[model samples]
Target: MTPALDIAHSVSGQPWHWRGGVIDGLSGSFQPDDLVTGLLLSRGCARDEIDAYRTPTIRSFMPDPSIFRDMDQAAERIVAAIRAQEKVTIFGDYDVDGATSAALLIRLLRGLGLDAGYYIPDRLMEGYGPSGEALVKLAEQGSSLIVTVDCGAQAFEALQQAKDAGVDVIVVDHHKCAAELPVAHSLVNPNRLDEEDGAAHGHLAAVGVAFLLGAAIVRRLRDTGYFDSRAEPKLIELLDIVALGTVADVAALHGLNRAFVAQGLKVMAAQRNIGINALLEASRLDRAPIASDLGFRLGPRINAGGRVGKSDLGVRLLTTEDPEEAKAIAAELEHFNEERRAIEAAVTEQALELGKGQDNRSVALVSGKGWHPGVIGIVASRLKEKLHRPAIVIALDADGIGKGSGRSVAGADLGSAVLAAKDTGLLMAGGGHPMAAGLTVAEDKIDALAEFLDARMADDVTRARGERALQLDAVVAPGGVTPALVEALEEGGPYGMGWPAPRIATGPVRVIKADIVGTDHVRAIVAGEDGRSLKTIAFRAADTPVGQAMLSAGTTRKLWVAGRAKIDDWGPRPAAELHLEDAAWAD
Candidate 1:
């Protein structure tokens, strides 16, 4: 029932437990820790259906779009716009998910010989989500039908204004919604109050929902023989955009989402999209991109556009056709990403200092005047990671108004708490998913808002913090760590926010070499009793207990290294290396 060596406590003082894995009934064809079986058990794969999950496909996981309440209405309206040649616009949020969702619709409409424009509100200027003023303005500009992607879920007033202005709107979003729906012609959201079968997919990102809508539109158009004269646009080709948006939004990678990313990576590797190709080059990615690359590399650059530069730049890049224009946009986004780092660093430093003085509160609420509104979300994320609890960072403007973004730990539903605060008239406006949220508040109400959130969510935060655990997938020996094993682990991917990459413990190894790398990284080569050795690297942990122990321990001492397996291509031949997260000395 217990591990051979107790690595229950990490250097940060969290207990680690092996995930719910069974060594028996594994078909007796492989070891308990074999890549395939480990992945299957970690994800709770059924014995008979293991093969199906091994290679997820849209055909296997795609649900009927009409299962959603307003899917048919939304699809039919879109088709009508295509037939009437009416001007349509896609209204989107400012993050990666919104940008990609807008781009998906624009591109889909374009392929059908329809000219579609897009509107992405400025992060600092417009705050978040669709506004009634912006919607009415678009209607005045001749857009008969407007589709809001990744937003409009909580735009009760904005949607009502748009409806009153005589403009038809379709909402394709996946944010959490209240019981009373927004006033729109059709709202295609899984989180809708009356949702039935579609509610099972409540975890989808806005782009994923948009992609479902795209499927419905294509199907309806096909039934009407709209594609007989013109070639049917291959919706599969757009999965690359879907993959990027889904991963960047931190959507759970289960069921259909895993299929999307798994197949989308293939589409991305084809280098078909000029914009994506340009972005890859800008990121210095010479090889094919993977799922993690979406979150760590491409997502950041796309987000940088909304964070520190022009908000529309991301959508423009994703929907562009000109190679030169793509390159220009990609380079601009790259520059913004660099700028974002500097701004985020400054804001994070200030927020951490403020957080240190608020240890008495369940949630860390830090605010500063003149902070960049664009970087508040990133700063909040950093604070949550460092503090291991709910965090809210606010950027106060000169006119006594503050725009705040918040992130929460797993068991804490900060989104619901924020919504509750907004309902109590404590916040001017606020909405978000369970783990993340955004709000606008009067400067003077900052303390009141903090107290309201803490009081409302105190018990939940405490329970969540108490249940946090480090889950390991399997165990391996030093000799078992090889490039072959690393490649085999791919069957369990594309790992992300909800669907984590597997972590393994390779133990009873003596440290042959350990040293500090560039900046604050710890690098070491550990060997087992069989004399098999492998390299490991702990990033940004040179001063931490784990890194210090690795560097200072004598060669005679043995330890278990815990981390994810990575393919190391630094040598002529590929090797497996561990991105070390934690290590414990062997008893």
Candidate 2:
């Protein structure tokens, strides 16, 4: 049945919408009395699946590794290398996903009595994927077997070159693949067009795919009696790395991916990996990291290595066993992160200025002659968020060739649009997922590319913007929001990306006090009809209607505050605070 969309006019003048899911099999078998279970039911979880979701064990959600196409082949090749003691090399992307994928395999192989080397393509000098020259060079350096992670899915020419050079290469990637496959020893990707059971897990990041490959390798070795004399490495311990990579890559946290993060957090909290521990210390996070910490803190430091510093730093940091070396690498990454932030800020300012002038265009296209290529992606993301449309930020080099990165708004397939541009000869090279993409283009063709995107993607962009709606989970009184409630809601979590944190609306509250806090945040305290007052903060919303309305609201005005409930431990007692997202007046 088509459910009616409940819509409300928020104080920000944007339409707030909620579409409640019918509790499947709710024949009065079990009734949820708490916020957590109610949140689960609202998000489409069946009563039977609640227990599994609450715990989210990999054993419960993990699919058999053999379900993927070429899984057997990929596993067999790795096992052969381990048996023969052949030198193996890992080629990984510079991003966190690639770094962790390489680190995971290197750690696994090292445990099995093989030392594997790794290579990361420089974002500036080498660009995105493996190059034919790099592959041939690695083969020349005595790497008998090479595995490419988070990349090589689009390396048709490079893979062919590797094959011609007599190097056996296995591709473990999650990027969108073309109809024509790359020539590799075995290409293992759930996103492959012809994949069956694996195709359902297309949302997996490359690191998730690597973990699956790890499982396959272990299973194959176990069957061959390779572990008869040796103690099997505990594969579960590596979930910490898996969790970091998966969350950093912004993979949707649902199904298997959620299980990975949920279990991975438990593994991470143990501080088993020296490098991870060092990173925690460097980031000033004394406690165990949450899902948001992976994305904001540690993830950015690792990404800083790829963006502005040495591309190999991330893999080195992740693989290092020496605590001192790990600490040094973490510190270096911290420095790089600072540099990246400065660079990103400058580029974002320029990109925003250029993007603001592009109000008439459906997609913002901003390019500069000397903007650093490393920071363009971040700038694109900022522009996309501000413009509420797809945004492309291009960095033009001396030869008039430009490297561009783009971010897409929800419901827009910017990556597909970029791919179409490549196919139309407007781009030199381009590919990505729906939300993000990268491309190379001639400086002179920027205008043509912009025109092409505007004309071709106009309808999609418009439809996407019009369909935007905020989904709220439940409504609760101010007194109902408590530390216990927040703790309970977390059971269904490790929430991120597609699996969002539950947002609740608390209504019939009068503003007790409101003021601007920090540079651009609105902070307020409101008293509900129950005379319970709660603190609320709306980040980066000072100038927006939501913030302005809250900040200037009269004491007599009663409003409903909608946002995620979070645990704030600033005081002696841990209390639940509302991270205000939106609000509406109530009678």
Candidate 3:
């Protein structure tokens, strides 16, 4: 609880705190030298669960699929369809999570010898969720059963239309739900208002829920002796996609989600999934991907299809059997990702300029008439990061209809606020989880919506920002920051979202040299009192206070540099470098 290194504030104006409280060598079950144990404890893992956290396994973290509401019914319906060889289509959102969920089910069904079709709604034409027209069209096309993944939780009218048209809709999603549910035959979401025991897994991404459904379907088939002759589909093989969707969606990495990623990475390494392997090659990643690669490299490429190119490309790439087709899709997605980055950069610049005018408001709500709707979510995320507040970027069309995407800071429930606004008639359509949300609104109501959110979330934003501090897992001198330490800390990984990588503070060092490298990155070499020099880079911070401080420090001023220690394998011999996040003046 005490301030780390006796400093009340860092250069970024935030205090640094030891994540696990001050570690006393003799008091706790773990010794001070056991960095992994300390990291596990700081991340809310119990002392008795150290071994489990160290090696997260599906068997240890996964819950029985039957624990969720409607699990048995959904599985029974799917098994029946499998037995009947009936036509079925998976209706998914046009995002990474949706693509992966659809791909997982399609692949699972393929292994069962029942081919299923898929539909991903165009982001620009059909919007975020399933529309009544699309659902009915799929039914009219001879599909008897439809499964909507990553969406449909809020598609009240769409689901009703499907029901009226004699189509059974099974909704497997992870979004927060309203008390009055939609008219789906089965709605399985851990965040359901009526969820009892399954609510413990509210942090699952939609792909994770689909993975559970996969397990449930397999179990039902096993119970019916359907797999006695044919081998049961190895559901574990699908964890690679599950991991991709889970990390790409920024779901909390703990428990089952953690196990999904940890094991998924291994499955990914096997190169069994032709589509994933092609994507890896397209991304120029020659080695097996870690958790960060999913979020940054692979996830973005898949999302680029939904954001800028053909919406179904991701699903097509993931579910394709032909390696050549997979390679072509991956290449196309890479091109789209590059285009997406350009559009996002332009939108972000304009949004940031507009955000400066809203400093008095709790939320950075910005809208532009000509802004591309596809890139608003990424722009909103960028705004949230820079402004240190909840942000919503709305793209208004000529008809005065606005499509908005929002990203929230920690402890601020932007999704709930958006949902409340919809309930109060401020939003025409809206739904999301705690961290991110999407909405449709009349452009005229933008101001009122902003006002409503400002009033509703002001206190939460204030408290969350007020309590913000740079959390440090360990503090060591520059000499102690080595490849060995970085490797040791990795034992606590595949870290992300709720479960973060260990942040090490190594300081009492003077900057030996500093320069701006790659656009907006501050790269520096610093040496401590022990005369040991190390490299540090602060990405996209050349214009920020931390970057400015590091650049101007020169060789005279001693400072504490805090960041995630990573192994720099680019050199002839592996060495350690700091992906610096924050720094403080030590003298």
Candidate 4:
């Protein structure tokens, strides 16, 4: 709804891109509050221009997974292994992917009444993946088939150890594959070298692949009589877990992942699982589930266990059938998550200081002594988003062994960069997708690793930055705020990494109310000339770039706002609110 001008307003000099897109297809106009959000729906199916925004689905395949090579084979092998009712152990990572993968596999196994046990390496002790110690032990415990969920692509030595101990290992992973994959009974990884599938799907976190494995396994079980004695465990039931792992682990939310998330949210809203329900209740989420709720609320709590507490925290919480046991583990994770936030704040400050001076080269490599290895990945991602550059955050131990995680910008090749560092013998072990990866470097070699990465990634960084542009959607006067607009976005969502929630642009408004909310958040209201306005809150902005921008802005300058519309029920009266982003003053 375009507002008629009652009085003369600020003259627009340089016009911005309307950042517009088709809305519900029938109405080709870009509504002001529906800019970035409309683009997300239009980018996908035409039919979804309306409903998908409210309920996004992976079932609709916008993301072409043909880019990944081994997805099909990896999916197929998992089916074959699961149908036989052979003893299985899911070896997963300590973080989100590993936790989700283990959860997915263990759930499937338990549903089928098969021997299923999950093993997550202790972050403080055993390191990552299936270690020699765990592998040998699994062999001794009479495990016939060992299915490594997230971490097996890097376990070359341990797989051989398992094989020698008379154990057949099946690796269902999504990581940078080595020249020689572990000599497992069968390695099912989208990142495997010899595969013929597409690379686009390789963006899936291990949990996503494990979901595919779950799908294939259920199919194979049907071909046999696995369900003859009992109804087969519904693969759809696992989608909730799949979606949780996929979104929480920050995988691309395109293609099947879209379906996973879209469907998963529905399942999650039903709160079928005792563990998921406990997690939701412990997190204090009032309304039903949304994709962001999983990322902001649930994912972090699950990861808290591995980051600062015991690695088994997530595994136990997800797998325990007992309500009291699940509640206990979930509660512990909630406490750990609180502690993790404090640790992250301190670690991020130290990293920012260390990264202050570096210039020109694309990657930001920050090393800190005695940092927690479990939380390195999130810190790397934070640094990358802050500087708009690739970043590798390393945690160095007293023993001079540095464990690190990396987050990459859109254009930079992070997987290759990690590989190059490893090639030069600076890293002990490391690999990942372009957007995110993990590795371990010797403490003394941190400088050499950073320098090595700069050389390899400098050109790509420059190329990526040179293509600067902003696609702003519809322009709206401050008078157009309404509850109806927020409701419309629901039909277009189920958003994730590849697909983002829409952001509306508005301007010619003055700051009405602005205050800091959480540990690092700013809450403010921007009012237009017509006495109409929107509420906005920015998270993690306290003492940061965005926080300072909102807190210190004077009322004299008219500022434009871009953010999502949310319904805040905090106070007795419920009303709509705005989440602030970038702003520019009207000249």
Candidate 5:
């Protein structure tokens, strides 16, 4: 069943003027399933075009890594570092992209029996970059080379410092690029300013880039006879970590990122890695790892380490081979998740309270003192949904540093904005992708940054908020949402991030029965004029927008319900049920 918030179908019933196939030679009225997963794909382009996305696979879809701007250089540099047997250090971000990239790197290096270790930046003290202090420390510890995963794209100053200190940096990052490239020794990013591929395959997260690097290293080693007649590590084995990190980082589930998940999920489901097995047990998820498991179950636990606990907890959890140690780390992360949630709630509540009466703006900036710095980004994202604006939330610490995170609406270039702000000397440091970004500012600059964002984003915000039409795929009848339909939908999944679940709109159902179920759940049976009926449930929506609307449904009123339908087995007879997404009173 779909969630209560799922809006299945959006049919602005303008009569179908063209009766025959709109195309010159087609004969059908465009069934999205024939080409796309759900009605959603049909909205963007022709059905035939979307068909390729339905069943994602490794062989059918993998793009050559060399297509990325700096992949070749990145590959050669990584292999050369490995051959030298240098004390290599992988500097990573604290999030899933960072951890998974670190894990993938660790797996690859260990497979070749090299001395490679990774360090993740501390979320609180070091922030999100290759800290100069840490880089100097690594050099002192005999680290001759450092490869940054998931970060360092914007670390021009830090990379300069590392270079001056006699440490080589092979940066493996996928963040948004700036006008001027950083000075890392071997910077490898698809988003490099000079990338000429029309593929524009910069959508991959850091972990995806690392996977490619792993593949490149293996290829190079094999070519050079380094693995001559010797057992070589299957680079594909690291896909599990790659997939988990890519999905967790919320990278677009397209192109190479899709390949990573397709291969990685298989490895994860099979429990190939001992540490991953321990994580699975700790998360208490279904044996098979689905995209949902990564999003809801695993990603959060991994992130908990960076949010309220040690930044290395995630790396520790991912790299440990011992079941006992992995299990212990998993438990600690689980506890940290609880703490993170509490802190997130507290920060969000305060932000919302402070922004109660703001007016007519394209951006919302909220600030709080002493709120946990780690959760501001999530809170900013939450506000973006409610207010439909580019939102930035900041929490100031006693040291007078404002830790801020921002989530942008469609069409806003958040990372660029942060870069611009930094260029103008208003920020201490900040850079990220368009949709998500972070910045560190002096405590006094929050209001100034807000004003700067408001001016820069006014036109874009107004254009987007004025566009509020719901997107629908195709309309379905109660009978159409059968077990067969559910199975068909699964073919396109596991969906998350950029690729969303499909929503089908059903007829204006007459309220046959409706009642509030579980603590805050709403359940009912909605029927059509032909007597066909389907059960529906809306979880955790008792007094919310959809909840209030459902409770008001009566026999006389015909309402359109849009959402994903799932087979519910809780009843004696397993039956189809609509997970109420959104509802509108019929005209």
Candidate 6:
């Protein structure tokens, strides 16, 4: 548990720790400088599992779909609908994960000649999850079956309403579930309390679960000779959206999820899906997107539609076949994204100002009337990042109903706390996974909810904050931070969430020059004792402690910079630069 370096504190006021101990007994075939091997070992891969971890694949990581509690039943029902040509609708949430999950199923059903319709509730009017009214209306609209993805684990009344309306509902979700299950035709969630065999994959996004159902349906069709006259749909092609949702949802990247991204990126590069192709072009990303692009670029654009514009635009863009329609939708989404950015900036500023007074509380909970509920989740994320603690942002309507979203730091279970609050009558509606959650509460009870969360999560927040050391995968000299090193390190990735990209500490060097660049980024040049200069930039840090330290170093003070080494592809020649995260004085 000792700090990676001899120094105990960095300029950011946190220590640096090695991600893992010395890696030994790796295959003899690997050279001493094989960074991928080292990265795998440091990330908890066993020596014998290096080969499997090196190239994660669905064939290697995918489990039996039938092992899930209701997977088979759900798939069978969907296939039966396809056979009977029954009207079907996909009910999804108003986020990237929901959009992608609904789109994946729609595309699959389209390939099977079903042409299933979709429903995404307006964020402002309908809020999160499928309501009883929405479900019963869909049933009354002649739809005989509905599939709710990325939500519905807590829709006790909604499911009951659907049942009473005589329409079957299948829940394909990954949210944490309470012990008392809702009344659905089938509920397929790996995180369900009764899920034993499939619970190992509790990290899957809703799209991941839908992908399993797709496979199961395909398998069932093949067994029943349903594909004897028609060509079976290639389910692998759908991984593109699966990858998009899994990353956008910020699901952990390991095991099956890693394979989904690693392979999905390849499928995306093929540009078979017209909707995705238009999205890539609209985002002005000329090259195939990496994991980061999905989260930062395309995902946000899709989310923008749900946040500020029409909620169905994302599902439409992802499922459309008309090139002109795709182009127009993509362009509209881009505009919405810009509008969303402006609104988010304003809300984030206000939330941060309000959060300034909550340093003593275990959670930073802020609320304001007339704030856009669509942007509360993003604002919560920003607050959590700034405060380094769990944060919740609630937008209260004129009627005193509050729509709240929360983001949690590592080791703090925000979703469970919200669920506990709902059980105790503090929340009217709430449920989510560990990292993020959504809820509804009365404006009058906001203070009580805050106090309940403070008491429940105080110990967890303290322990997580006390262990706030930056983790480094390796240490390299300034000259060693080259394009080759970046390439070597990438063999261990498609990194996101749980499977973190490797970070290296490079320095014991003096700052040669430093200046504020675009927006609030700090760009600097530093030279090691060997006289090799390296480029580094700390994004959105010009006003922060690390940025201030780098700006004041002024070629005299020596320090170590820790960050991910990435190749600067925009340059004439590929060179490496550090996306600096933290720094510590060496002398």
Clashes of each: 0, 0, 0, 34, 8, 0
Per-residue error at 2 for model 5, in Å?
21
Give me the overall lDDT of model 6. 0.91
For residues 46-87, what per-residue lDDT tens digits would candidate 2 score against the true structure? 899988877788999899999999999999999999999999
TM-score of each: 0.94, 0.92, 0.97, 0.89, 0.88, 0.96
Q: Write one digit per residue (lDDT tens) for candidate 4, span 135-239.
A: 999878877777888888878788888888987787878778877767876666667767665455677778877766666666666766667889878878877
Ranking by TM-score: 3, 6, 1, 2, 4, 5
Ranking by lDDT: 3, 6, 1, 2, 5, 4
lDDT of 1 by residue, 1-587 (tens): 22354566766677777776632211213343365766776777777766667888889899999999999999999999999999999999999999999999999999988989999999988879999999999999999999999999899999999989999999998887888888999999998878999999988999999999999999999999998999999999999999999999999898899889988999999987889999999998877888989998999999999988999999999999999999999999999999999898888889988998877788999999989998998899978877889999999999989999999988888888998888999999988888899999999999999999889889998898888877777677777767666666766788887778878778778999999987578999999877889899988678678798889777887887788888885778778899988787775
Error of 2 at 297 (Å): 2.0
Model 4 residue 276 CA deviation in Å? 0.5
- lDDT of candidate 5? 0.75
Residue-level lDDT of model 3, residues 1-587, one tens digit each, is 21248668888889988898554311113333476787888999999999988899999999999999999899999999999999999999899999999999999999998899999999988899999999999999999999999999999999999999999999999998999999988999999999999999999999999999999999989988998999888999999999999999999999999999999999999988999999999999876688999999999999999999999999999999899999999999999999999999899999999998888999999999889899999999989988899999999999999999999998999888999999999998999988999999998899999999999999999999999999988776676667777767788888999999888787688999999988689999999786889999999899988899999998899898889888885788889899998998988
Kindly list the per-residue Cα lDDT of model 5 for residues 357-430, writing each as its tens digit.
Answer: 66666788887788888888778977886566788898898988888889987677788788888888889988
Score each candidate by Cα lDDT. 0.87, 0.86, 0.91, 0.73, 0.75, 0.91
Candidate with more favorable, higher TM-score: 4 or 6 = 6
Candidate 5: misplaced stretches above 4 Å? Answer: 1-52, 510-544, 554-556, 566-577
Q: Higher-lDDT candidate among 3 and 4?
A: 3
Candidate closer to the true structure by TM-score (higher is better), 3 or 5: 3
Q: Which window of 10 residues has the lowest lDDT sum in candidate 5?
A: 18-27
* Model 3: CA > 4 A from native: 1-4, 21-33
TM for candidate 1 is 0.94
lDDT tens readout by residue for model 6, 364-409: 9999998999899999998998899999999999999999999999
RMSD of each: 2.8, 3.8, 2.5, 4.3, 4.8, 2.8
Q: 149 in model 1: Cα distance from truth in Å?
A: 0.6
Off by over 4 Å in 4: 1-86, 198-200, 542-549
Q: What is the lDDT of residue 1 in candidate 1?
A: 25
